[model samples]
Target: MTLTLPPAPHGGPRAGRHLVDAALWPDVARLPRASALRTAVARRIVERAVRRLPLRVRTPGAAAPALPRQPRGSADGLPTLILHDPGAFFRRIGADGLIGFGESYMAGEWDGDDLVGVLTVLAGHVDDLVPQALRRLRGAWVHRRPASDRNTVDGARRNVHRHYDLSNELFATFLDPTLTYSSAVFASLPAGAEDLSAAQHRKIDRLLDLAGTGPGTTLLEIGTGWGELAVRAARRGARVRTVTLSREQRDLALRRVAEAGLRDRVTVELCDYRRVDGTYDAVVSVEMIEAVGAAYWPAYFGALHRLLAPGGRAVLQAITMPHERMLHTARTHTWISKYVFPGGLVPSREAIARHSAAAGLSLVHDTGYGEHYAETLRLWRERFLGRSAEVSALGFDHVFRRMWELYLAYSEAGFRSRYLDVRQLVLTGRTTADRGTG
Candidate 1:
């Protein structure tokens, strides 16, 4: 059923807050508190960032010339961000730095033909934008992670549903035919190389290879992302059993499995990793650990340890942040947690290694591919905009549309700036003393 909502006011003070979808209101209400002192501090931060921004930013190979930063209008055919109300945008940032930055976008305070590109510049200079002295204040603004958003068995279901269950069609419109949502392994992202589906296949193949999955192999997948991994593993003659908390994903994955005539070899169960039973020769989890709250890190890795057979190997693809940043922001509920992925906490490499050691597992090999993830998001964002009409036909309002765009750009910028990284790790139990290559 299509949900029809009165058009949200595009320009006004606080109208955006009132206009955010009902489910998101709770998060908006929690936006950082306003204060004269904080506003003063924010002013300094904003000024520093703005000053550090390159006045002349070049867009290589573009059809137009370099763009002026924060121009009132397009400069020489190149895109420029026009801040309709500079005061309001700055004030929101003053009130709540990160949250306000996103809300300002939702409120239509800024725009450009290349939103992602503009954000990319800012992301590249994130370190210079904020002074080291002021970084300590980040933890001072204490907003505890919501208890209800914990990754307990029951909490996990609600959090997973909040995003994945929106509509398979919604994801389908943006994804390639493979329906893979995570990063693709593009060996060489030439202008006209193999399409995204082929890259996705390569990525899945890498994970399968890392897990040593093959004929008669019993594979246990901790996250069932539309059954792509399971299908690929089964094609290698591995018996696959994948678990997921998403009902929507499970339903469609089962259908896809049956459609491929691998239903007999593959099992798609509506299950949580913490409660998964039995063991397998290989275990694989892709970008699922981010959703496991920090509090459950031990339990999550322990589950992997217990489930892996003695000679079996495990492959995990995780999104990671810097250890210091992770510790500082782990407890805060940011725009991502509130609007897109609830109860999610990205782990740092240090955290992962520590947890794995605790779980009696060794990180034998690891590889980093942050740039590939940025490209993946860039393609998805372009595809999303190309299918805007279809998206609206699915009942998403304008505010919802802007929110998704910002979410995609935000993630892309993080990777482009080296603020975020994605890793593929191979793990094995450390039975005799210890062993690790990473």
Candidate 2:
């Protein structure tokens, strides 16, 4: 049955009052009798659906809040948040559906007196979002695809370009000066003193320490973002080779290396890690595995193993989910695969261990710093928002800014809530008898 909403309310005073009128009785006075009957049926269905949730409607405060104008069809079963400027709310809902609600906040479409409080309430009631959860599961099943060659090189490049190549200026405005585009390690910070640059340095130092890096050592970096780690390694007297698919990253990293007079000791290549063949004293990949896709984990680990010298160690840092016997529901996975990070899936610890073991690598040390990542992202978001004007001037439009903001904030929330984790694993390819710590 078709559903019809009431005519948009008049502008100016009493505009808030008309929200109820439009939501309850959208204009259908002149419609045919059959059409009117269908509208009524749809309205009843919507009303019943809304009633099923524990929503607490509040009066408009200073702003004429918008309610969900779209008909609460089966696809719109998720709960909605009433907001000031209901027109903006309708626009978001129409544009992105349930996801739009969160996106709108990132876009600054609506603001609450207490955003954190509202989020807490919504998070507390997440269990009531069963229908949305089911939709996610259904999406996973109906949209499975094989991880083919196109998915790895070209497809992955396109995805990276869409997000990372937006502009180096934009990234530098928010990211730490080092421009290390990965999770940071904040091990030695007093409660709130964890700065991005400091944390990134700690991560680099941790990797170097784990690999037993020293002068004359050869270090290989997979997925070099802006080449900060390579430069740092070279500064410590180690020759470094880094590989990345992002053209922007390679060009900028190489320029930085040259500027530092480390061109002879450091090289950044626009290449895939699988194609890279070399034996190095140490290897590292920071936040690169997400794009490798779960099916390719074994190949990725094997590639790292081959690149490392006997008794040499490799340090890897990536985001992960808690152990799950099965992958995420289709709907959630598809959203990430489509809108966020195409060909990306966060592997569990068990999955990582199994894959590494199959690749002839033994985990020597493992650390979880998921909470530090949350703090890192939060700092990035604050910096990004603080420099919004500069970012916009750097050619980021509304949609692009919104996408980045949502990506940063949601990632922070995921880590903070423990729904996501960041892990650093030190692996050695030597046998137990050789290293004695297999």
What's the count of clashing pairs in each model shown? 0, 9
TM-score of each: 0.86, 0.74
Please report, as a residue range, the 10-residue window in candidate 1 with the lowest summed lDDT: 1-10
Cand. 1 TM to true fold: 0.86
Task: Write model 2 residue lDDT over 14-82, tens digit each, in one string.
Answer: 222232233322221111122333333333433333445433223255332233344355343333343
Name the runs in model 1 displaced over 4 angstroms: 1-33, 55-80, 139-142, 430-438
On the 0 to 100 scale, the lDDT of residue 385 in model 1 is: 85
What local lDDT does model 2 show for residue 258?
92
In model 2, the clashing pairs are 5-26, 6-26, 6-27, 7-27, 65-83, 65-84, 66-86, 136-331, 140-330
Candidate 1 lDDT tens digits, 76-134: 54324545444455566776667777777776655656777667767677667778997
All candidates: CA RMSD (Å): 7.4, 9.0
Query: Whole-model Cα lDDT per candidate?
Result: 0.79, 0.66
Q: Candidate 1 — what's its lDDT? A: 0.79
